[model samples]
Target: MKKVALVSLISIFIAITVLSGCSSNNTSENTSKVENTATNDASTNQTKTNDTAVTNETTTEQGVPEKYDPPIEMTTVGVNYPTVKFSEGESRTDNVWTRAYLDKFGIKLNYKWVVDDTQLEQKTNLMLSTGEIPDFMNVTDIQFKQLYDAGLIEDLTDVYEKYASESVKRMMTAGGPIAMDSAKFNGRLMGIPYTMSNKEVADVIFIRQDWMDKLGLPAPKSMQDVLAISEAFTTKDPDGNGKADTFGLAADKGMTMLNGFINGYHAYRDLWIKDSTGNLVYSDIQPEMRAALQALQGMYKSKQLDQEFSVKEFAKVSESLAASKVGILYYPPYGGSYPLQSVRDNNPSSDWTAYPLPSIDSTPAAPQVGASTNGYWVVKKGYEHPEAILKIMDFWIKTFYENKSREVMEKYVTTPDGNTPWLLSAIFSYEGFFNVDVQQDIKAVIEGSKKFDDINPIAQDTYTKVMNFVERKDEKFWGFDEVYGLHGARAITKEVYLANNLFTENQFYSTATQTMGVKMATLQKMRDVAFTKIITGAPIEEFDQFVESWNKSGGEQITKEVNDWYKSK
Candidate 1:
């Protein structure tokens, strides 16, 4: 019966894959054909192209060749996160994943150095400044721009076009052209962009359903409703602890309001939005922001917001949530797993549900979301085999997603402890990968064509946790249920996507402008201070003065530079 079930599941997946215009049978053969076509095309175009840098070098057509005639040595630098664990004898440079790369593609990875997450940016900056760049390294947008400007990184346009696997190309551009566009400078692709779905940034309001139920209030639909709820949550003692300690909202100094509370008033602080004339304007200085600040002032004065919020850090704020001291927060979809998970662990009775932000009036709240592309992969200017990076990425995508062989899945995909092996490959995947798959499986399950057990392992794990919560099998699985279950955070994101309510950041400048690079930090500090002061009861009039001061203190120049960059784009 188990074998039959496995075969049935594979058949279903194959059908789905075929419908998506991908072959589920013999991925290796398909990969080889793609590789051969790319290589032939590169050879044919080599003579006609004007790029003198690329020579007519004979290259293997196989995406992951059995072995190179002579093994290729590549050096890179990566963050060795503290949480990453190695097996008994495996090290960063010779781990199971790295060894697989060597065995499959004849690529030997040598780490110039592995730094902790804290030191990655500083050390990479130092390396770039001193011209000690490795063969390939992951770099921030600013560093990528700097390297392109300095002519220290290879123009990967031709190499990537010739060598990247079709699956990779599709995945990189799946979200939109923005991912690839961000990596381009002057119409030439300089780096491999780390792509993520724009939907990942969609903001939602997470409220304690139990608290609402206790107070006999409906889910909020307008700013007025939210305010009334806040007032009630603050005064009614919904936690039932018989103490007047609970508040309405959670906030931290790092991000004063997580999803930009000002967005509820159609004001996006620290973001760029278009005015009625379609001219780009900074959100912080707008009149809408003044109204938002005034509203926050009212909340603070009414004791609906935390009085000590200005001084609270993220950990402290999360602790307050875990202790049931706060009942509302604006956060991204992933909040179900992190701080909210801790809340479930601490107070199992708490029930959180996500809702779209309430509008100030009849106009729906369109919150401004931002990009999630953290970094990119770039090869040194003179690396002999820039395509090696793409080849490694091809291997990762194939092994991680397409490979259905049980042996490969059990050995390479999962660790000995039955956890997913963190690939940390130098490639980006669509942020919506798992959620999109889960959503599809959900539809299939609803239609009686699939079961939760038939989904991918990660989704299956999530399903198990959700079932555990729904069936009351475990209290700890409540967070998983809230995040990955049928009516969870992912569902809310899907709704936002379907409703066309998601708004992306207008600014696509990958790096800071000249004036912005120098003045942005100081300006942000000033903005934070002004916002905190205004929220904590400094006269609301102070916001106008701060706006005036901002323009004078390089804000005008920065705005001009940003607009100039936008026009160039």
Candidate 2:
């Protein structure tokens, strides 16, 4: 009976696999035929001409010879962002668009682990330390370097250059590929890179619009205007409770608010420099930091910031803002969503909107553009069919380009009139092939998409949200566009558009992508202590002392290390 039960399980598994159309056979050569049949069955919407273009361009028609079943699985690991949900019971095995395309190519996905959004770094470190390393891992810069130095990761320079599909190769040339160079150690690619857009935009300050109107105040247009507005909202008690319980600004003490205040000053909290030739060098150690510290001390002394902020976790920042107690917040438009969305849901009459970050010197400083770090699928070294993984990747390019699968097209394709098919398409028609059109559309909208009178409220809301962000050009606060667009609704907005621009072509070493685990661990503590004290106004004079302590406690070393890594690249 036990044997029969085992046999029954195997049979059931096979049936499910067949019905789902994903083959996990023992040879690489079977990949092409399987993928072809699946693609044909999956969709009939694709024109033959378009599909032929995919087949011919991808070399899917004649790349690997027939008859061999690919025998390998690519292991991937990353934080579980909302867009890439992997719940064991809820997630579909073959239902994922990317996985279905790979089924045709005879490659299998084996996830190493799924971590909560907040605890990703911690879980990743535990995995690394235990040496229970999976075949591939999506790690930060600190982790990448540590693993490479420990010789746990294989170099992919030759493989990437020689075997990377045309689509992947093309992406490498579109600027910021220099970041891939950061993963290079002793002249070899240590890991595959996850990519993000390089377009730049600043964070915006969002306020409760209803409060502004209630107080008969217009939107803030300058730094002093913002301060006055904040003061009024806090001290004037716009909420009508008549209690002095309001915080003027909702800042998580340690985090920098410069991005939301990008209207005029090119500020630096960490290691900015000025060239002898009069260029503003990156300024972690500048006199400007002193002035910035002084301003922050004043805010703390005035009790304008959240007093309980030091104990807040990163995710909870939204909670405080959403409660309608935070009169002022600094973030991108979408960043305002948690609070705004809650307000909209619980009280649709709630009026809230975003505005540009404040300017210090009346010039837009360089926005912080987060280095491109994204989900990447990579193969294990010595896998019997490494070619299978390459073929799988090639299959994705074809699948997305040809828009072949009905399942995907139904989900993702939104017509100009906004008609969506039942399935999801990985390639959005509005987004286009290179992702540049989407970028342009965002910019165009921020310049004014609201002018169209017949726009849907959802679209209008999106536009309002996005436009609130576009007015600022600082890139640091605008890193999450692709994820937001892919995960959020189809409606375009100024913030989304500006975020699209922030993801353009530049080559900075992504500190987030490097594997500097030890450095990160040390820095977190120092960051917590220093930021809290600075924001709470422990003392203005102690800032210099804090900086000194921060340096002694590894902040300086990390900076030097990062610079060294940058120079080496």
Candidate 3:
């Protein structure tokens, strides 16, 4: 699930982990990030120019890898996702993608064993503990370090330089050096990072417009308005049920959507932000967070916030949304596609739309973005062709990302069975905001500013889905239109938050600090408990006590270690 994006629009998580806010246009287009440590000066689109210098048996004169005469065979692990259906005679080993790897690059991709995508990490982890691994595979950040520390991985700095395509290099650097640099240790590239869009995780407010129209309320321009709408939806019978049976907002035990409301107060949970004194500090413990918790406390007491939120999961919240028992929601860009669109399905008159976050006061709320790069593609030590993975990756980017073609989409990317086979590829990497780029394409086509004929196959597919909803009133494609539609979540995210620079990326992009590994899980659980207590009507002073407890319980050491890492950078 970690590499979910390589398969779908998310269809958006990132938190690299499905993760999930924002405010004003025009006033806020530069990303409101804290001090970013990346200074990677790698030339954009860095390319090798030896068009006529045919190298040895493994590479072409143009600096890209050419097919080997005997074929370079590598043993690796693979994921067999249930959603990926092969042609009648094709299996994971014989699919269009795997066949192309051998036919085009002369690489024999042998799967040592295959498992469900969910079990890939467990299988990989088992292999690592046993002191053996496939020729190449993806691993978590922590696992990457373990492999490196044990001298079980290859250094890909030179391998990337020699074998990577121009497009691959560009994708790696597109989001800046952090994504690529996260793979580096002692200035050596250990793996190829899977980069994603922070904006994809940034949530927005999704409200039922029919409910708002019924209440004669103005759309939210501030957090105050949001609260009022919440109150009205909960109290004024917005659903016209004549029963006080609705919740003002959707929430869950994980606090997924509610965090958007919390982020509006300028408090970012699970992020290390820079303070006025130029030191990195954890965000959840800040004073601003206390204020936000107090607000939730009031909402909970008033029954505006879901009373059962403490017991419900995101799936439960989605059920509430579909049942029309909830009005306003804060979720990732994919909310419409998942929970919100279901509301319309159950009730044809219901319409859910996306809006940017509103400020709490004079200052705009900057949507908190977590680190987008998580998994890394690494090769085992002493593999005969460590660079083979790069050739496969280069093909993926060109065929699926750069100028995607309908022929490839039908034959290789998406199958006639309505399945995705690209996820079956041996390695995965992507432009962080590639989908947002597609959003622009769809937007341009709708505006008639760009010819629909010029858009890539991916965007063309999106256009068809959107038009299906717009023209035929198709409930099946409702979520599709909700995201790529004229005022879809991505549209607001790109046209407003991005264009106005109302979002901020987390400052701590490096791997976990030493203290993080030992204490982070416990500290996270403790913080969630404290926040939950406060949001459920505990005394506001409970936050101060919680802060004191956190400081004494290794939080102080973690902060120091975090700052040490930041300062070293």
Candidate 4:
């Protein structure tokens, strides 16, 4: 019996061992399957993260997205001239179109502060000094440098490369490589340049066509002609008002008013900077500047200037223009738009034409240039996603400026659609000269009907107008080419004639120089004192004393600084 039990136990042990082996094999197979599954899951998750970066877009409530988050929010500061507040029935934060667009794309503008022109710089400095740095600040070059040195801003080189859409990268500056170079600091992009091309015809000297006819004077062709016309207007009673109210030119010689003639004569106040070689130089210290001042002094003495030259504010000059007390003035369209509109509102019979400033003797010297670039938005140093601003910039360049060099448009217009009409005609102002005709180009390229190369030259020109510059004052005045082109010649000479009569092309200036700034302040003060004294019949030779004092006080330093800057450039 014992032997039989032993055999049975031995057989059971073998059976148990075989069963255990089979179980272990099955467990191994299951473990392998689980590992593979996890691997696939992780791969999928990584892909989703990348896809979110590329394809993530959505709308939010409040008409537009008030907060965009993946999730993050950044505070920023901004300023607007004349205040960008909406009129009655308008929202302070968002416009209808902006709200709709923002809702469609999930973005928001969180303004830390909004200042008017008067308070912009003061507020900016106060914020900076207090270490209450916002996410970003958009300011002028000098302001930018200060912020940069104070550790308030960031080096945007790598951020721009990684996040900025290719098109936004291209728009860092205008005037090609040179302007972009200027905006860079310590070999890194400290700021993005405000890209605007040089518009050839900005300020044009406007004369009353009706007044010219009444006076029976052929359109004044030269400085002498203008003087003759003004003399006649003052003494001959061209208005037949029987009062000595009409003046040769109703200029407000306030430092800022009637400054365009100073520009036409290349005699812009203290801000007249020029770039030579690679450095900035001041223009006020030039010998030609003395000539310009002397000429203005002469005009003041002859009683040909506005009678209230010293006390008149800039806004008053426009009032004079609209009220018909002024016959000729140098102004940009934007400066004159309200007054001109008001004139039309009051008298439809008042015929007003906007033409470019005539060239001085058919040379480049005849033209006066203003700010080549305007406002530019900047990204903050360490916003959770500096890329978000770049993405927004990309969107603006693509949607508003028609830039096509980014990945965002992979789905919208599948192929190059040259025939696609523009949907944003309201922003583009299709009726005006600055308009870009991109609708057809979009349509043709997408439909496989046209290649980008086949798009018309006119369309190309329109594209150039949009992306290469900031918004200009007048639709009629194209860029520098059109100003110097055949269509602009007649008007060029006309401006030259008027300007020469008033003053000569004293110097060339770049808008961004340091030395000219100081000189300009001193010269302006001198002019203010001299003009007031002379017009009130102060000794004319006080001009000589003023000039002497000017050179002695900061004037010599400014001249030396400017010349040194020029030489360095």
For candidate 3, lDDT tens digit of each residue in 1-569?
24333232222211111101111111111121111011111112222222121111123424444786688888877766755666698777877777778877788888888876567666778888998888987777788888899999999999888777677788787766678867888889998887655555477888889999988989899999999999998899988879999888777887756768877888877788889999989998998898889988988898998887888876677778889999888776666766666788899899887888887888888887666565788899999888788888777776656633455544555543455565677766656665566667878888899877677656666666677789887777787677777766777777777777776667776668888878989999999898888888889999999999999999999999888877777
Better lDDT candidate (1, 4): 1
Provide the overall lDDT of each model, using Cα atoms, as 2-decimal numbers.
0.65, 0.46, 0.71, 0.43
lDDT of 2 by residue, 1-569 (tens): 11111111122111111111122121111001010001112222233332333445554424453213653455655333333333255342233544544434444556666555556667777877876676654565666766666766666776676677766655444434554665566677766654433322234566777889999998776677787887787788877888887777766534544334422344444332434653333344345555665665666567776667666643455566556677776643234333345544454445566655555565533344433433233334454544544554454544443343333332322222223211221211101112223333343444565242233222222333343334443222122231122222112223443444432122335444233445656555664576567667666667677667766766566656555655565
> lDDT per residue, candidate 4, 275-347, as tens digits?
4554434454444445555655666666667757677665666566666666666653322333444444454
lDDT agreement of model 1 with the native: 0.65
Clashes in model 1: which pairs?
none
Q: For model 3, what is the error of residue 413's alpha carbon versus the real structure, in angstroms, after optimal superposition?
A: 0.8
Model 4: ten consecutive residues of lowest lDDT: 33-42
Query: What is candidate 1's lDDT per residue for 1-569, written digit by digit as tens?
Result: 11111122222221112111111121111001000000001011111222111111213455545466488999987655443466788778877678766766688898988766556667777888998798987777878878888999999998888777776787687656767888899889998875544454366788989899989999898988888888899999898889889888777675434444667888876776667876667888999888988988888888877888777776677778878899888875556655677777787777899887788988778766555354678899999888888877666656556543334443445432433344444343443344545645654654578864455443443454466667766776566566556776757666665356456465644588888889988998998899889988899889999999999999999888877777777
Give the total clashing residue pairs for model 4. 33
Instruction: Name the candidate that leads on TM-score.
Output: 3
After TM-score superposition, the amount by which residue 261's alpha carbon in candidate 1 deviates from its true location, in angstroms, is 2.8
Give the number of the best model, judged by lDDT.
Answer: 3
Candidate 2, residue 357: how far the Cα is off, in Å: 2.3
Q: RMSD in angstroms, all models?
A: 12.0, 12.3, 8.0, 24.9
